[model samples]
Target chain A: MLEAISDWLQSTWLSHAFISQGLWAWPMSESLHFMGLCLLVGSVGLIDLRMLGMARGISVAALHKLVPFGVGGYLVNVLTGSLFVIGDADQYIFNDAFRVKMLFMLIAGLNVLFFYSSAFQKTKLLGPDDSMPLNVKIMAGVSLTCWIVIISAGRLITFYRP
Target chain B: MEALFIWIETSPLSLWVRGESGWHMAFPIIIVFHALGMGFLVGVALAINGRVLGLAPQVPLGKLRQFLPVAMLALVVNVISGILLLIGYPTKALTNPVFYIKLLCIALALWNLRWFSYSVLTNPIYDHGVLPQKTRQLATASIVLWASAIIAGRLLAYTYNNMMSI
Candidate 1:
């Protein structure tokens, strides 16, 4: 079933565009991906450090504003990442490293959902003197680990290609 | 320089890194670590620069300094990994002008970090207030420098003319 989907996707026009563009497309996408990685990790990682009680002098609300840049970075990655997958579906769909990356991304997504639903309100109420709860700290730790692993695994994809 | 490149290329460590047998994984793993280090270093710099630019005015500049240690740690990782990479393929990088450009950008960015720390982060007014024009200008320059550094580093792969000893 996965192979079928991959085959169909590779046959699509998006894939043709990516292939036809040839040399420039891959490099451009890779460059953008790297930029997005920096932006996402920088902003979101700062927020994570704050939640983990590293920079308690900063108000949580103010640090929260940086999350939008992280989100913007994520969007850029998703768009470029999709183009990559569309361009060469077989390279990703059947690859173990890509599968692991997807798993990590899914877990990271769930962690975000949990953060907003359960912890964001409490975080918003926090003043400079207040410390984040243990649960929030755990979530922040998980987020940092996941992102680091995701990046590592993403790089490993080339090595682990089938 | 050619002799040095040849000597380094034939060294045991470099040979191991370039070897196509059991040690093949070493080079790619080093590259992966390089990317990870770049993410942390550049990312933290961006956050600090953003804060300096008043993106999060409520966060004290001094408090943001806490992230500096982590960024420094990442820089250390990058330096070590980068050296190993250069050892593995000295000719590829040393022969390329882009690599030196990357180094220059990194040096300037680090200098900008120190300058910001001394001039703006330590200032009490920037604790919970807007940064002065001069500090803001430094912050902007820091961002541009780091961005350029990343680009130059990425372009190294494409720009190199020699893959082994010159």
Candidate 2:
């Protein structure tokens, strides 16, 4: 089933462009991917650290404003990530490291949903020095760990490629 | 130069780093750390850069100082890992012009951060409003340099003339 999906995705125009766009495409997208990684990690880390009780002088609500940039980074990475998987699906779908990366990303995604559904309002009301609720701290901790694992696994993809 | 590159590449530590000897996981581990270090180092700097550009107007500029320690520690990680990587492939990085550009951009970006540190961050009176023109310029320049540095670093893999001397 996975192989079939990979084949179908590879037949798409997106994969065609990614495969034939000359030498510049891969490096260019990789650069943008790295840039997006930095932007997303930085903004999200700032908020996470703050929620977990570091950077106690910055208000949660104020820092939340930076989420837009993180969202932008997420969009850039999704686009670039799609290009990679679409162009060379077997390289990712059959790679354990890539699978782990996707798993970690899924965990991170679920954490995002949990935050908005359960903690967003209370988080917004948090003052700079207020003690974070245990669950919120858990969310932040999970997020930080997931991102670290996701990045590590993503880097290992090349080494583990099929 | 050739002799120097060969010397470093054949060193025991480099061999270990390159997975030619010792535990084979070292190279991947080093690069993994490098990426994590980048996430913290560049990430925090970009956050600070965003702050300076008035993205989070209510946050005290000095408050951002709380995050610098993590970035500093990450910088240390990158330096150590970067040196190890360079040792493992001196010819690859040294022969590539993009590598030098990346280094220069990083140096200037750090210099830009220092300028922001002393001028804007330390000023207790200026946390919330429009900062001085020069201060904004520093952040803008830091942002540009950081983006360029990352792009150049990525390009090094594609542009290198030699993988190693030996």
Off by over 4 Å in 2: none
Q: How well is each residue in A1-162 modelled by candidate 1, as lDDT tens digits?
A: 999999999999999999899767887788788889999888888788878877767777888888889999999999999999999999999999899999999999999999999989988898975788899999999998899889999988988878
- The C-alpha TM-scores of every prediction are 0.94, 0.98
Compute the lDDT of residue B107 as modeled in candidate 1: 99
Question: A43-87 in candidate 2: lDDT tens per residue?
Answer: 887899898999887889988888899999989999999999999
In candidate 1, stretches whose alpha carbon ends up further than 4 angstroms from where it belongs are B19-22
DockQ for the candidate 1 complex? 0.76
lDDT of 1 at A156: 86
Candidate 1 has which clashing residue pairs, if any? none
TM-score of chain A of 2: 0.97
